[model samples]
Target: MGIGGGVFLGPVLLLIGFASPKNIAGICSAFVLVNSVVGLLSHSLQGRVDLSVLFFLGLVVFAGAQVGSFLGTRKFSPLLLQRIFAFILLAVSLKLGIGISG
Candidate 1:
């Protein structure tokens, strides 16, 4: 019933609440970790697991996440990070919209 927490929660928490960006990032990180675990388990139980592809993709995603989290949380100002996040969301939305239309 409540807002599903993930990428959207970070910005909402930062803008509408009193939490710092770093704290919001930490909370979002935990949500991502838990969601990933649950998703993996559900897929595996459904007999849709692909260990080989998951292994390679997980490695790439893990490396990127580490670097991204470090820079996003520690190096950038909150306003700059919010701008970057909005830009990314806009780009992804446009890409999906174009894909859906075409």
Candidate 2:
């Protein structure tokens, strides 16, 4: 599945020391939109698309994206966002490393 360029691109930019949250979010959002559309089309062609699930998931994702876009572009200070992102990554890493049953 296409996880979208946004997922990796924004963090890579940050790691390379880019400090513009607005620019990063904007670029990533665009990439995610394109990737999502292409992915959905490909899945649909293979008869694996679920319209019912997509419809509800799409709504929630749209709302979350809207909020994230606003916060990332305006409310979140760059340092705070970076720290938060790092924490999330760490949490995920630990979770994967330790396994869910632990």
Task: List per-prediction Cα lDDT, in the order shown.
Answer: 0.77, 0.77
Each candidate's TM vs. the true structure? 0.71, 0.71
lDDT of 1 by residue, 1-102 (tens): 122358577777878986876677778888887888888898899999888799899999899999988898678998987677678667756866788623
Looking at model 1, residue 56 earns an lDDT score of 94
| Best candidate according to TM-score | 1
Residue 29 of model 1 has an lDDT of 82
lDDT of 2: 0.77
lDDT of 2 by residue, 1-102 (tens): 734555568788877868575676677678878888888899899999988798899899989988887888778897887687778667756776798724
Per-structure clash totals for the candidates: 0, 0
